[model samples]
Target: MSTREEILFELGITPRWKLRDVAEIESSEETSSSEDLHKGAISSNASGDWSELKTTIESCDRCKLCESRKKVVVGVGDPAANWLFIGEGPGAEEDERGEPFVGRAGQLLDNMLLAMRLNRRENVYIANVVKCRPPGNRNPEPDEVDACSSFLDQQIDLIAPQVIVLLGKVAAHRVIGGDGTLASYRGVEHRYKNISTVVTYHPAYLLRNQLDKAKAWKDLCFAMDLMDKKIEQRK
Candidate 1:
């Protein structure tokens, strides 16, 4: 298959071909036990702090993805950043490198952040709803999401970001909790633990449908504007 075909396949879009075409596509744990594990862990680890949270993620075996991951992608960028970017999970490349958003999709995300005059190492941090890659790049299951939700919550508490950009369906579904489409989630600032949240297309999705980059840009700008408001409120 060619590069175009591969991308289409990855996105699960059917390809047009000469008698042949194809495309395909495609957590956490908790305290020992809790209804909202991450929520609880966020409070408990508040005192344990960032290092404890990172160590927990790195050594986590709350879910089966841990069995297969080469290295757990904890997160990256400013620990105290005002901007936080959360995606679905680590992809193959991310799993290999033990970092989130470091592949083709990552490059696009970097460009998007640069457009906002931000970079991961400075004013922004990047992470995933799930730390480990789902086998075969598939969407993470509910059990997996539940298992890993606490780690994410802990990360959020530590960073205390002013605005959260939830990229793609999984992040939206996990954080926002709805059956609505991604369109429904966009253009509105929802609240997750009282922090402003904006939903947007994942960079991987933008890689396939370049047209949506405009919409994603709008989402990013909205997030930036919200962050500005949050900063002013603090002052």
Candidate 2:
């Protein structure tokens, strides 16, 4: 049996090739090597504070994306959530809707969350490394991530989640700040802002590579186990 088949067996989810074929996400990246940057001054905000962070993001002009964004997706779900899902940035649909992980990718994510018996509307908080959507949905520029790092840091500090599941390589790099490959980062528990962290394929990537859903499922299980251990340790 193939890895994908094995995972489907383990999860008890039926495999439908036609459905899988229909779910492939088209590449949203534009063919532009131009690094046209917006030269806006970045301002420092109060650390360990939520209001200040939200205000800064709403009015941020530190990166080029701020100029083109329809809305800055700070986050959604419970502020005091024990689980936080962090992604790279907003996509076209997310940008338009002013919410992260909306549309198909979001739907897949919702399914994933459902599979784990967790709901985004409940004890799960979702946010991205960069609040603003990059033009054409490209990877967030390093400077953009840097400018927004403070906000993400503040959010982590504020939420104080037991486990953070990073949703892509970009998120792994932004949170962990290392040169390690995503494969190397997976299955190992890392720390971000002193909170336990796990790395996984982004839902968008999983949409394109359905076989990896099993691995991503493993990562989610790892995160849940870690959170359970933490809760037990608190007793």
lDDT (CA) for every model shown?
0.77, 0.75
Candidate 1 — which pairs collide?
A: 9-23, 9-24, 27-147, 27-148, 28-147, 28-148, 29-147, 38-150
Give one digit per residue, the lDDT tens place, for model 1 in 86-167: 9999999999999999999998787776555567797578999999999999999999999999889888888887678999
Error at 229, model 1, angstroms: 1.9
Q: Against the true structure, what is each candidate's TM-score?
A: 0.79, 0.79
User: Best lDDT goes to which candidate?
Assistant: 1
- Model number with the top TM-score: 2
Per-residue alpha-carbon lDDT of candidate 2 for residues 121-186, written as tens digits (9 for 90 to 100): 877789999999999889998889998988888888787777889999999999888867889889
Mark the regions of model 2 whose C-alpha exceeds 4 Å error after superposition.
1-49
CA RMSD of each candidate after superposition = 13.5, 13.3
